[model samples]
Structure formats: C-alpha cells, structure tokens
Target chain A: MDERAALDLVGGLVGRAGDDAAVVDGTVVTTDMLHESTDFPAGTTRYTAGWRAVGASLSDVAAMGAEATAAVAVYGAPAFDAADLEAFLSGARDVCERVDAEYVGGDLDGHDEFTVASTALGETDDPVTRAGATADDVVCVTGGLGRSAAALRAFDAGDVDRANDLFQFTPRVAAGRALAPYATAMMDSSDGLARSLHQLAAASDCTIDVDEAAVPAVDAVADYATDDADAREMTVFFGEDFELVCTLPDDEIATARDACPVELTVVGDVTGDTAAASSDGAVTVGGDALPDRGFTHGD
Target chain B: MDERAALDLVGGLVGRAGDDAAVVDGTVVTTDMLHESTDFPAGTTRYTAGWRAVGASLSDVAAMGAEATAAVAVYGAPAFDAADLEAFLSGARDVCERVDAEYVGGDLDGHDEFTVASTALGETDDPVTRAGATADDVVCVTGGLGRSAAALRAFDAGDVDRANDLFQFTPRVAAGRALAPYATAMMDSSDGLARSLHQLAAASDCTIDVDEAAVPAVDAVADYATDDADAREMTVFFGEDFELVCTLPDDEIATARDACPVELTVVGDVTGDTAAASSDGAVTVGGDALPDRGFTHGD
Candidate 1:
C-alpha cells in the first residue's frame, strides 16, 4: 500500500486523516521526517536542515491553532562532526524558540545517510479541524503561496542564497490563533493550494471553487511563469508555502481577517455539491478543470 | 559531541535530559529512531522491524511509568513492496495494541534506505524520573537481563530465529506502573545495567555498588559468557534488554516487588559518595571494577 492507503487504514483510529496534526486529550501532536538525500538539495546546510525540519512540524501545530509546547528530534546519521551537530541542535533550539516552544532532547543513532525525524507537541483549547465548513463559507489563505516552489526552482538554477532566503518561512502561528475563534475549517497549505482545497472539500463535505485570478501571486514565481502557463499554477500546484488556508462564515470573515496579524486573502467560496471528486467536480477558472497537483512522499 | 553531551547542551530548556520521556502538562512524549542497516540484522523481517521500532519507544513510556495513549511513525524507505508496508503497519499496530496504546497515523516518505522513526505519547498522574533516588534506597531490577546481548550473539551465529525470539521483549509497563508510587528513581535498562546504575548515581549524586553474585543473569548469556567473564558484566555491558531498573526504599522493597508482576532482583544499594565516576567508583566481586559497558551509536 502507498502512504495514502496506509493512512486510510489507520484513519478510523486517528480521526481526521489529512489534518496537519492529531488532537488527543487536549494535546496536538504531529511528526515530520526529513532525509538528507531527498529533502535537502545539494546546497542545503545542516543548520538549515535542523531549522527546516523542526519548523515544518511546528507549522502543523499552527495549522491546528495550537500553542507549541515542546519538541523532540530523533537524528540518524553515519557520523557527525562535533561542530555540525552543535550547530544543528542550535538551529533546532532557535526555531523552537521562534515559535515560543521548548526544545526537548531526543534520541540519536547511526545510519548510512543523514535523517531527522522531528515531533512537535502542542495544546489548544478550541482546535479548528478541517471538517466544519459549509455552503457559502468564505475561503481565505494566510500570506502568499509559491515561495517554496520558486525557491526550489532557484536552487536548481544555482541561486542558492535566494532559495535559502525563500525557504525561511514564518509558521503563521499568530494568524492561526487569531482565526481559530472564527474559522469553520482550517489547514496548512504546504501541499499546494489545489490539493489543500481538495482535502478541505473532502473533510468538510463541500465544494471549494477558486477564482484563479484572485489568488495573490508572489513576485518570485512571476519571473518563472510563461505566457502559456498561469502564474497561479505555481502557487496552486507546487507547495511548501506554510500558509494557513481557512474557511470562515461570510459574517465572520471581516473580523477574522482584521484580527489576523498577517495578510489574509479571500480567494474562494464553498458550495454544497458532489463536486469535490476529480471527475467534473472542481474548476480553477471558467470551464477549466482543477486537477489535483502537489507533493506526496513516495509518490 | 556525543549524544549525552548534545543533550546536556539543551538540558537547560527541558530540565531532565536522560529521562525516558519528557512530561509536559500531564503528557509524556518520547521518540526513537531505527535504521535498517545498523538496527536490523541481515535476516530481520519487516514485521519485526516495525514491532521493534514502535516497541522501543513504548519501552521509554514504560520507563517513565506512563500509560501510553497514542503513537505515530515516520517511515522513510526506498520503494517498499505493498506487502512489506502492510506488514510493517500491522506490526506497528500490534505492538501498540499490546501496550494498550492507539496507533495514530504518521508520516511516510521515500528514502534510499529503510528508516522508521516512532514517537509515543503517554500520560501519568505521578511520573517517575531518574533523579530522585536517595542515599539509602535499595536498587532493584525488573526481569532478568542479557536477553538482547545474547540475541546479538545468536544473530552473529546465523541463528536468526533464536535471535528474533530473544529480541522480542515485553516492555515492563505493568511493572513500572506498580513501582511508580514507591520507587525513588527509575529508567529502562536498555543501555545495560551498569550504565543504568551509573546514570542513576550521576543523576541522584550517589554511589551504587552491586553484590555481583546477587545480580540476575539469563541463561542465554550464561552460555555465551566465558570462564573469566563475570556473570554481572554479561548483564551490564551489552544492551537493549528493556527491563526496568529502579531504586526503592528498603522499607518498600518487599511490597514493591510483591506487587510487581515481573520478577524483581535486588542487586545493589545507594550510598552517598562522589566516586561513581567510571574510573573506579563501581565494583563487583573481589573489588573488580564494574567498568562502563553498553552501546553508543557511532562511538
């Protein structure tokens, strides 16, 4: 079975399958893994690896509108330099502090290649899962998308500095907290906008239609867009934006957006229909089918 | 820096560095990593891999005397057969079931080698840690030791079945829970009995001396022990036993042991001394130094 199939098998026990984190007895728990070979490109540094790995899991905490409490990492590598390990741990500690969480110590072991598995523990009084949206709910996203996609492109093109800069994303914790009280459904848009919409649709049992031109396109991806390609596709199809996608009742959108510390853009609305399926259900623009596009590990 | 040194660097934030799991707001969190190359022997089955990975982390929960609630795994491996993945998940699920914990969903990614990183979340009203032993406490252990060490020897000799049987250990969750209220300090003997004693002494600032003959030794290791080799060293040096080594008050030893489901062995006592250092503090029969012995990855 593939990853998704494995998830489906365990979905009955964990509850919401595609949600960023699982809530168990008031605790929001999430884990992420990063293999140096596939996750870190040639230009990546150990410091960045530690920071990005911890931050990615922390982003899941944000998606659940939880305050991160503590994090632990299990690091596996053949051998590490004393300085590199220290710097890597420093990066993890710094990132946890950035999200106002404690960095707990974890296990270390030897492996042929460098691999890090990080878990973030969080707590939330009123978590917002991706299962409450209804018809006419306004769908909004925090910040812009396609930054990481653009960064990957830049890295491939040897613009290492720009790529690194673009990959250093803030986890939108404050915005998620602000929207938690108002949002009906919420998730992190790390797996691309289109995929997020599909997941939200499936969870909330509603159809999410995006006005393609309405998506706030970041400038980094604009230079990479061709005439035949829609610049929004970069934002919708490629991921790692770490932005929060939330659906709020129309009456609550104004207050949620106003209370949010970051830029919140309303880009779509939910409709009740059997339109969440791929066969003629979702559309990106006029008569254009919205295909599922994004990243899935092991795919 | 070594693993312990790296933990000491982050010790300020998390408080106790070597505890089985970190407790935050009544929740217990711990993580463990397993790589196929070093962790798994040549003929290790995928089913055993998943069981051992999840079971290893759960053993930590047992060390803390916490009841496990949920577990998540981050599996990264080169393309695996569908049957292998299914068996792996089944193994994970079965292990969690054995401990009465939920097999919550986890992350899956593709990597060059098989790597499973598992984290277990647990809870307890009164958690037992490794820093509370007093000078007069009687040091005791749950279950016999040297099973894993002997298993390794068997594995080296092409006795895969015996190795697997010996390696499949029962985590002392029940025993730990029974001892939690009475024991002053506790930890898993996965790193070996001598190393565990040294750690307990270091954490509690006391000295522990073993009456060599009184220490329990499994027959599996006795067959492998040489004439000159001390029986206690066989149980102390090699690791991965998953037994609980605890310090209890002399007044409470009888009741604690009687209450424990696992067989209990009293091998030593706690004394006030600064001589617990590796050079000469610990001693066995005839004043022979019980040197530090156990596994350290990549050492």
Candidate 2:
C-alpha cells in the first residue's frame, strides 16, 4: 500500500474523523509533522521551517471554520543550537500572532534528523466539514494558487530568494471564519486543487465541475515557473497553496467575499453527477478528466 | 549540547510554558513525537508503539488535572503496510478509549523512519502546573515507579514481552482530576523522579526532601533488574514510568489521597531551602543527592 492507502486504512479505524482536523466538544484539534529532508529543501531557513510547520496545522483549523486559540510544538533535532531554536520559535510566534492565536508551549527532543511536530486548537460552535456541500453549492477558493509550486521550480533553478518568498504562506484564518457560516463545505488547498476537489467531492458524495477559465493563477506564478506549463494547469496539479476552498450558495458567495480579507474567486460548481468524476477518473475539468496528480509522500 | 540543554534553550523562548502541556482558555494542548529508532526497542510491537506515543501525551494531560477530550496522531513511515498501520491505529484508539477520549484525527506523511506525532487535548477550568507548589506543600507521587526502568533492563536481556507489558502504561486521568483542586503543583514522571523533582523545584523555586523509606518499588522491578542498586534509587534515576507527581499541603495529602483512584504516597516535603537543591545539586535524598540520570535523547 502507498502512504495514501495506508492513511485511508488508519482513517477508517478512527471514528467520526474527517479530512483536515477533527472536532470534539466544540474544539478543533489538528497535528502536522515536518522532517528536514521531506519538508525543507536546501536554503530553507529555520525561521521558515517554524512558520511553515505551525502554519500547515493552523490552516486545518481555518478549514474547519473555527477561531484558533492556541498551538504547541514538539521539536526534534540531532544537535541543538541556541540561535536556530530562537529563530524557529520566533517564526512560530509571529505566525500565531498573525492569526491572533497563542504559541503556548511544546516539548523538545533529540533525533537523528530535525523534525517539528505542531498541534493547533481552535473553537467553533459550528464546524464546516468536507461532507456538508450540496449539489447546488458554488465552489469558491480564497486567494490564488501555484505560488508554492512555482517556488519549488524556482528553488530548483537556484533562485533561493524567490522560492523563499513563495514558501512563506499566510493561512486563510480570517477568510475561513468569514465563509464558515455560509459555506456548505470547506477545506484547505494544501494538496493540489484537483486532489482537494476530489476529496471534498468524495466526502460529500457529489461531483465538482471545474471551469478551466475561472481558475485564477497567482501573478508571480507564471513568471517564476521554469517551464511553460499553463499556469492554470500548474495551479491544478501543484499543492501547498494554503488557501481556503469552500462551497456555498451563489448568493452567499458575495457575503463571504465581502467578509474575507483576501480576494475570492469562483473556481467551479458542485454537481449532482457523482459518477462522472468517479468512473475511472479523479476530477472533471470541463469535459476532460483530471487525474489526482500532485505531490505523493514517500513515492 | 545534549537534549536537556537544547530543550532548555527552546524553553526560554516560550512564555510561562511549563514542563508538561500548556493550558490555554481551559484547554490543555500537548504534542509528542516518537521516532522508531530512538523510542522503540528491537522487540517492540506496532501496537505498543502507537499506544506509547499517544499515552505519553495523554499522561501530560493527566498531569495538568484535565479530563482528556480528544487526540490526533500524525503517522509517517517509509513504506506503508496495511497491517502495521492498522495495529498502530488500533493501539491509539484503544488507549484513547481507556482515557474516555476520542482518537479524533491527524495528518499522514511518508519518511525514511517510522514516526508518530500525537497531540492530546483536555479540558480543565483550573489546570495544576509545576510552578504552583509553595514551600508548605508536601511532595507526593502516584503509584510505584521503576517498571520502565526495569523494563529497559528486561528489553536488553531479551525479555520483549515483559518490556512491552511495562511500556503500555495508563495515564492517571481520574486520579489527576480527583487531586486537581487540592494539589498545588503537578507533573508526570516520564523523565524520571529525580529529573521531575529538579524540574518542579526549578519551576516552583522550592526544595524537595525525599524520604528514603517513603519511596515505593514495584515488586517486579527488583526481580527484573540485573544490577545491585537500590530499587528506590533505581526508580528515582530511571524514567518512562507514566506516573503522576504532585505537591499539596501536608494536611491536604489525606484528602487528595482519599480522592485518588490509585495509591498516593507521600515521598517528600516541599521546603523553603530552594538554594540547597539549586546549588548545582538535584533531588535531595537523605543527605546524598540523586542526580537526574534518566534517558537523555541524542546523548
């Protein structure tokens, strides 16, 4: 079994769990672990490592439509450096401040490789899960995509500064909060846009139709990519954008957009034709099939 | 620097963070990561690995006098196996059920080494921290110790079953809740009694004088050990016994003891002689000093 298949097996055993974080007694809890080899490339700063690790988990809280409260981190490194630890912590604190959450505390250990495990907690009376979308819901995404993907290419090309800028992403905490009450379903586009749609659709037992023209590419993505792959396709296949993807009624979109601190774009529509995308296919982009393509861990 | 020194550097960055989990707005959050190589002995089962990973964090919740609500785990393995993953998840779910908490959800990734990162959440209106003990308080520990210490000896001696049995520990959730209101300070003895005492003293700025006869040794511990050391001293220096240690008033000890579901032993007295323990010495045992000598990661 691949990592995804193994995860699916484990998920089946865990009761009442959804993609992203889990909600228990009005609190949303989530965890993410970043290893130096898999999570950080060369030139990735310790500060960025701290920020990215915490931000990844916090994004799950946003996906749940909850107000983030606090976060704790467990750090494991072979050798401890006073300055490196400080930078990493400062990064986490700054990111927590951005979302008005507390970097409360965590544990530290020694390991053969540097590892960071972060857990974030948030509170919400109503949590928006991936299964809540309806056939008539309109699909909308906060901010744009392909920045992280394009940054990876830039990093490969030795443009460390450009890639670093793209690596630093802002979690859509405010945007998720603004859309939660109206959104029929929601999740973060941490995986590629195509995979995210497939997951949400599978969870809701519905089909999502993507309007190829409607997908907005981040401005810097096109200029930064090393290849000439269409920016929209790049956005669809590349992951780690950290944007909020939500499905709501068409009329509610405006209210959500007005409430959000960032730009909102309508990317697709929720459809009743569930079989259209599941028949030996992944996602529907216009009439073409878009296989679930993105980063696969341990591949 | 070693793990402790490195951890000290990181601890300085976090504000008001205690040794165990941190409490925020009545919610207790803690994270722990277990790398297979460092954490698991050769004969450890996947189920035991899962249980130990989640149980360690839950023990932190118990130390804070909180009722655990939920837990999430992030699993990373080089190549996924369905059976292995199931065993791991089953272990986590079973442990959570034991504590009356739900194993909610978490992230999954792939890596070269098997790693389990678990985050536990609990609720407490008043959290018992390590810094709350005053000079007038009495230091006590729940249950007997040195099982894990003895377990380590057994593992080295090829007694896998004995070691695994000892590794699977129950978090003191009920006992912690029972003692929360009365205890002045609290923490888990995951890092050995000596280290825990030193930490509590440093955090609370009070000295603890351990009575030699008061320390209880598990009957199995003596039989399992290969060396000729004092059983109680072995308990003090060896760690990973998931028991609770707290400080309360000398008179309130009985009330706390009456409230506990487990045996609560008065091991020492919290005193005003802070400088005595802090003057490059750790944990006073009779006239001799018990050095913090438990497992040190990356040592």
| Displacement of the residue B280 alpha carbon in candidate 2, Å | 7.4
| Candidate 2 chain B lowest-lDDT run of ten | B273-282
Query: Which lDDT value does model 1 have at A21?
Result: 92
RMSD of each: 2.7, 1.9
Give the alpha carbon lDDT tens digit for every residue of B183-299 in model 2.
988999988888898899888887777886787777668787656565765687777888999999998888889999999999988867566555546467765666767766667
lDDT by residue (B18-95, candidate 1, tens digit) is 688888777888998888776888777777777788888888999998888888888777775667777777777888
Q: Predicted candidate 1: what Cα RMSD to the true structure?
A: 2.7
For model 1, the chain A TM-score is: 0.92
Off by over 4 Å in 2: A226-230, A275-282, B227-233, B275-282
User: What is the alpha-carbon interface RMSD for each candidate?
Assistant: 2.8, 1.4
Candidate 2 residues A1-299, lDDT tens each? 87667767766887666578888889988888888887888888888888888998899999999998888888788777888888889888888998999998787777778889999889999999988787778899888898787777778889888787788788888888988889988999988888888888888888888886788778777786555566765688778779988899987888888888899999998867566555645357775776777755666
The local distance difference test score of model 2 is: 0.83
**Could you say which candidate leads in TM-score?**
2
Positional deviation of residue A271's Cα in model 1 after best superposition, in angstroms: 2.4
Per-residue lDDT value at B160 in model 2? 90
